[model samples]
Target: MKFFNEESDFFGLTKLKERFYSSDHDGLSEADREYINRIKGQNPFGIISMFIGGVSFAFGPIYVAFPIITIIFCFLTCGTFDREKEDNPWTFIIGFCLALIGLFMYLRGVVHELIV
Candidate 1:
């Protein structure tokens, strides 16, 4: 069986499913390919963290737990950039920064409330 993980810009769908594809799709056995394809398709937590981290900033004053959740997701993912393969997996970094910012804002608000 042949599998392809070639990067392509197709109908804006690539952006949505970018995590599903990777450079190391070749040379794997049929079972491994199928396993990665159907079961462990992608590390979705990074993308989930990115979205929630972005929203967490707005929710900083209201939902303090959101930033915490986002931070946890970022740490759990193997999000380092694979320079050997030239892959830029940036979702974790972006999510981490956003989550930190959100958390800081939340703490600042609480401190302000206490002071006032």
Candidate 2:
């Protein structure tokens, strides 16, 4: 049976197939597809890591949690940048800077006990 039509419903598979094969597909190379999948796979892990890192940093020792969380955030920001480089680099830079700032503040607080 014909799959392409205005109202032909093959459990939405036809629509999905249409979207998958549309002109948008032309913009995606094999490497891009692989990278997209890799980023997608890493997203959940990164989110969990970020959450855990934040909790540890907020509640645990600054010396231990600050570096660990900073590293996690750095990795997450790198992954995010890789996924959206074509769209904007500023976001990645901002995220990286924030992570660094957080790390620095934590270190300063632990060392000098100065609120400033």
Q: Which candidate is the best by TM-score?
A: 1
Residue range 1-116, candidate 2, lDDT tens digits: 13223223424433543454344546788998767644422233234445555544453335555545655544533433224323434443444444455566566665324322
Least lDDT summed over 10 consecutive residues: which range in candidate 2? 1-10
- C-alpha local distance difference test of each model: 0.60, 0.45
lDDT per residue for candidate 1 within 39-85, as digits (tens), equals 53224545666788787766755678988887765654433223343
The TM-score between candidate 1 and the true structure equals: 0.51
Task: State every prediction's TM-score relative to the real structure.
Answer: 0.51, 0.32
Best-fitting candidate, scored by lDDT: 1
lDDT of the structure predicted as candidate 2: 0.45
